[model samples]
Target: MAKTNYQELVFDITRLIPPGRVCSYGAIADYLALGSARMVGWALRNSFIHDGIPAHRVVNSKGELSGRAHFNPPSLMQQLLEAEGVKVENDRVVNFKEVFWHPEELGW
Candidate 1:
């Protein structure tokens, strides 16, 4: 077996997300048909810094922010997402249905 180039996978996932909307780690994994949320998390953590991936926009399937520690000052992701007009409360996005990015709509 070969190690996947998850860095590339992360960017590809990020590109699938449109501005003002977001996706979950599981969604990204499933979109790539990878079948593992942990793999998505690992990929995002490793690639976020240098790749300029919109890491902040990815949350857990329940819309809970789970990558706080990875952010500088530990709250940057929430702040950035909020700045983009995506509401965050208790470290989770409110009404994600209104802001969910569908890959099919974007032709991903």
Candidate 2:
């Protein structure tokens, strides 16, 4: 696939994460068969400034906001997630499993 196509695919998958839920970069990459969480992170970093992508909902495998630094102020990601009712502490999502969204399990 073309580079933009890949990024757009990542964005599309990211949008599937509902409010108050989160997914991991590895999860999105796995869902698209990309085999690289770093690729997903790159896409998010490049496209985050755009509207509707909700890159904040994507975290690391450990439920930590590993991409937090990409956001302005480096705390917007946590704030956004928290605003949506997902508790965050020490840069990690509290009760991550309960609020985690898996693309494969989603019938989308």
Candidate 3:
């Protein structure tokens, strides 16, 4: 896929993440057959400005808000997640497995 297309795919998948649920960068990368979690992070870093893409819903595999630094306020990502009822403590989701949304399970 073209670079722009790949980025778009990342954003699209991110948007599908339900409120209060999170998906890992590796999951999104694997869903698109990209084989690189960093690619998903790169796309999110560049496309986060797009209004429809809920970039905050994407987290690191360990359920940590590793991408928090990329947000404008940095803490915005945690705030957003908390607003949706996803508890975050010490920069990590409190009940990660309970709230994790897997792309493969969605059959997308």
Q: Which candidate achieves the best lDDT against the true structure?
A: 2
TM-score of each: 0.87, 0.92, 0.92
Model 2 Cα RMSD, 1 decimal: 2.2
Model 1 lDDT tens row, 1-108: 133776586667676677678898887777777658888888788765575678888888888889888888778988889888999999889988889875556563
Measured with C-alpha atoms, the lDDT of residue 101 in candidate 1 is: 77
lDDT value, candidate 1, whole model: 0.79
Segments in model 1 whose C-alpha atoms lie over 4 Å from true places: 1-4
**Per-residue lDDT over 13-36 for candidate 3, one digit per residue giving the tens place of the 0 to 100 score:** 888899999999999998888659
Candidate ordering by lDDT (highest first): 2, 3, 1
lDDT of 3: 0.90
lDDT of each: 0.79, 0.91, 0.90
Model 3 misplaced regions, further than 4 Å: 1-4
Model 2 lDDT per residue over 17-106, tens place: 999999999999988996599999999998756888899999999999999999899999999999999999999999999999999877
Considering summed lDDT, which 10 consecutive residues are worst modelled in model 3?
A: 1-10
How much does each candidate deviate from the true structure in C-alpha RMSD? 3.0, 2.2, 2.1
